[model samples]
Target: MTQPIAQPAQSTVPASKVLDRVLVLEMVRVTEAAAIGAAKLIGRGDEKAADAAAVEAMRAALNELYMDGTVVIGEGERDEAPMLFIGEKVGLAPGKGPKIDIALDPLEGTTITAKAGPNALAVLAVAEEGGLLNAPDVYMDKIAVGPGYPDGIIDLDRTVTENVTALAQAKGVAPSDIVACVLDRTRHDDIITELRGLGCGIVLISDGDVAGVIATTNEDTGIDIYVGQGGAPEGVLAAAALRCVGGQFKGRLVFRNDDERARAKKWGITDLNKQYDLTELAKGDCIFAATGVTDGSLLAGVKRKKSGVMTTESVVMRASSGTVRWVRGEHRAKV
Candidate 1:
């Protein structure tokens, strides 16, 4: 069984005035606890067990927030998954003060957790009501550049080489100075070939596009650009992070199967190729939180012991004030 993290003594923030927003942050902390709980079960080699634990804990945590929140972009649409499904209601039972929009991925990397691979997390982002775009579960082609690259340096429609050359030119550096991250799959062969031909270094991820996209925004990661097809949900979450860090990202939905197209239709999405700027996906003022389930560039995986557990998280930015906080939390197990 899993246990909740020990809550700090009541915050100095007044409950009547600031508690609503503070409750949202606390909700995110609970989700982190849920993810760490599930991660402990990863090494035991049961995928279902891990996902089930995470989903349940995350749902319970969301339910505890004091405001009325709706899942704008969530696990799946109605008839898809139960907890945190799109359109699901969250927060206090009834008559809550403010309404908010929530975007969450209870288990960002189910496979990574199951295989005990690197870079998995419990991720969530919140914004004002109707702030987040309703993203269907589909592939999104994305291109991102770090802060130093002047705006308009990379174009998603441009050829890979063209974009790389443009980035190099914008930075007044040679192509070799750029490091691009892409998914490590055979489908990315052409992208890899083009980058290599341009004298750019490549860092490939086996899974987890969130890490790949976020990597480009951080200086220490050595990733200048992230380009490839990845989960649409992750794209929104990444956009929220990039918003605070002053990076640029553009994404377009890619439908691989009839079912995916059908899903898109339900969302009133007529153009599958329409490009979405980061702001379009994650609208005004978003707070993003993520706790690593396994070790990766941005955060350390949860560590557990008989008496207590320790978890690390990287909170890219808070929509309210655009502050970035990276927190390490330690929880002592109850006797």
Candidate 2:
């Protein structure tokens, strides 16, 4: 059985207002709730159950907030998803807050969670109205690098070898000393082969390119660059993260069928082959938050104790302030 959401809030404040810091912490709570919900289904071998639980939990938490939010990027369109679909309103119906555009993946790696694999996350991003790109659900070719590099360090149009070579030179390292993260998919065979032939280190992930992309920002991950094709919505989310922290990301949407092209058009994206940079994908003051569902590089997974206390790890970032906050939360059992 599903519970009905309360009437959502209307936008009364101007859209130009920057997102408040309080809202940033609230966003962490949202991802944390989603992570806890999906954690219960880990290793259950039921991907759908895990995803549905996350979506339900995330939506419920979102509706409790104080803002008027529209889901610009979400699970799917109205018919494709029962909840958290595109354009669905969230937050308290009578509250006074600024209008926000939200992009979220309640469970970024459903299969990974089902198999108890790694790098699964509950992720979300919020921005002022028209701040985040209304990216449609489709595949996108993406390349990214961490901070401390010159502008235009990576490009989707360049060959993998050329991009890696340029990045390595910028870092004053040999091409063989560079490390790259990529999704393990047959479509990326050429990318892997080229990296290997160039003698560069490679880290192949089964799923969750968002984590793979974020790995580029942290040197501790030993990931110097991220290159591959993944979901366009995810690319936008990653761009938001880089926008908050510091990095360079470029993405170009890839359409396989006429339906996908039409979906792009429906989203008001007319430039089918245009490559988007970091700011273009996610501009204006924004906030990005992610909680680990399964232990991975970005953050640790949810942990439950016999005393009924649960622990979660999350990272929340604000673009306006360039503040990256790492939060550790404990949920004590209710008496």
Candidate 3:
């Protein structure tokens, strides 16, 4: 189960502390390590094993870094996961470097990896202290669109059809020409139905909402918008990705019962119904990094050669510079 984070007293760290550009590649290395770790378990049909392998690899890699970091969005509570749990401290030596907050999904698609499906990835985001939202592990209602549209083009409060129609008009295409990505879950049937009724194309992914949300920003994916409900932690991670490139994202917490609401309150959220934009979720020059564990639209999967060599594809982006770098690596040894 997910644990609520204890709000810390305002840190003395200056708000202007900029994340070093080199950390971007470091993040790529971290995700690559995790992807390779999980890739070894691909098609094994053991989701738990795959996820545990990823968590172990990612935590090991993070600990080798030179900064003082906290796992804001990690596996779960200290009791739920022995390592990489929320509030777990990482990095080489504490108090020796910049204070960084990390939000990660060691393996974004556990079932996908277990089944050797496409679009599996190892994902994480980093920002200066207090930069990322400490979102509880609960459902989040989300709506997002790619760049070049008006600032307020998509609203969570609006109907799916209306948002899709508005996006179509902005792209100078008919509603039927618009493509929206959504998770294939019973909870989103209403959203799927509305898009179908509007003649909008829908991409229903079985998992990995982070990739689904990020797909909107990549024109090659032909995904104009993404809408539905998913993990709130993934929502913050996806928002970080959009922050680095260009996009608009809005998310509202969805609590099913009193316990869920109590978790939200523990994380310092008072306005349960308040819609959060991209900046609100991630702020202050954050970095987003992802490595494909399996082939998909966003990136190529890790490939192993017969010569005991492995290749990985990753993308690392920084919000401050709006710089996005695609890295292709050939690891002489196992990542």
lDDT per residue as tens, model 2, 164-268: 999999999999999999999999999999999999999999999988888888777789999999999999999988887788899999999999999999999
Tens-digit lDDT track for model 3 on 143-252?
Answer: 98877888899999888888888888898999999989999999888888888898988999989999999888877788899999999999999998988778789999
TM-score of every candidate: 0.89, 0.94, 0.94
Q: Rate the local accuracy (lDDT) of all candidates.
A: 0.76, 0.89, 0.88
Model 1 Cα lDDT, one tens digit per residue, 1-335: 11121111232212223224575457557668677667777767777778778888887887776777788778787787867788888888545556777788877877789889888888887777767778888889999886656667777889888888898888788988899999998888989988888888899888888778888866677788899988898898888766655678999999999999988888778888898887788766667778888887777778776666655554545544545666667766666
How much does candidate 3 score in TM-score?
0.94
List the pairs of residues colliding in candidate 3: none
Ranked by lDDT, the better of candidates 1 and 3 is: 3
- In angstroms, give how far residue 198 of model 1 lies from its true place: 1.7
Name the best candidate (by lDDT): 2
Tell me the deviation in Å of residue 36 in model 3: 0.5
Candidate 1 wrongly placed segments (more than 4 Å): 1-24, 93-95, 314-316
Residue 222 lDDT (model 3): 81
